[model samples]
Target: MKRSPMKPGKPLVRTPFKRTSPMPSTGMLSVQSHQRTAPKRKAGLKSKGPVSTPIRRAARGQDCTLRLTVCNFDPDTTVLCHSNYLADGKGMGLKAPDTAAAFGCSACHDVLDGRRPRPADLSLAGLEAAFRAAVSHTHEILRSMGLLDAAPAAIQPTLEHP
Candidate 1:
């Protein structure tokens, strides 16, 4: 019988072929084969890939507050949180159901458990100051990133909800 070459201190015994789990060792590999299998749990929405994502990349340096700051309104967890925002930054227009961070007080109800009313409703006269601030913020955000050169028209929100 011919034998293959061996290194200085290696063994020659080979184990039978079988699949092993990625779990920690349980003293014996055989134990894995005999172990009870739990019911397979379905991966759910909360453990998701991404929700409320943006359409276009935030022009240049503009921080996509809608997409980036999502710890509050997790579209995954809330069934009530009508997610029209994920396809694109549509809610930013304040016309759609999705991109309404600076525009939706309704979202405050989602995160704050209804303790605080919606912060930025265009209908409220008091929020005009806030609305202008948002416009300015948008303008500055665009200018800084060099996207304002051919600036998209300033968004003039109406009572209309698209």
Candidate 2:
């Protein structure tokens, strides 16, 4: 049998996939691109501003120039730091409120979040203790500033025992 020479420049033709309807103008497949469109808002629903969380409320009540409470390493820059337990999904079952959050620098926050390795001398337990202490201090500061409501008398122990 004699073989025919193939064309040097011509490309093979491909059969286009058939669709019940034409694809969108964006050139994306219709079904896969549905989510790319903006979502429709429900009727009678008004957009509201961001709701203030307890942590934010407490932080705002403090002096903006304050340093990170955990390491006290950064005096000029600080950010809110929530409990590692909270970020780890373990604090959901605990009674700790949003006010339990403390202030820390990016490094300390990273360490707490396990994104960075802990210091050679510092243990996870030590860091947690420091965070808790910072939270307590923050609460006190908030309380002194009249941001947080006073603790219930029942929760405070009396020195005099009946």
Highest lDDT against the true fold, candidate: 2
Q: What TM-score would every model get versus the actual structure? A: 0.25, 0.51
- RMSD for all candidates, in order, please: 17.5, 9.4
TM-score of 1: 0.25
For candidate 1, the 10 contiguous residues with the lowest summed lDDT are 62-71
- In model 1, state the lDDT of residue 92: 50
Candidate 1 local distance difference test against the native = 0.40
How many clashes in candidate 2?
0
Candidate 2 per-residue C-alpha lDDT over 1-162 given as tens digits, one digit per residue, 9 for 90 to 100: 698787989887767965556565886555654434678989857546545665565454233221323344653445566665745334643434556566666666677677878778776677777777777777776678676777767666569878
Per-residue alpha-carbon lDDT of model 1 for 4-111, expressed as tens digits? Answer: 677888877767965464667667665445666898878762454434433223422333223211235433332212223334244553333322223222333243
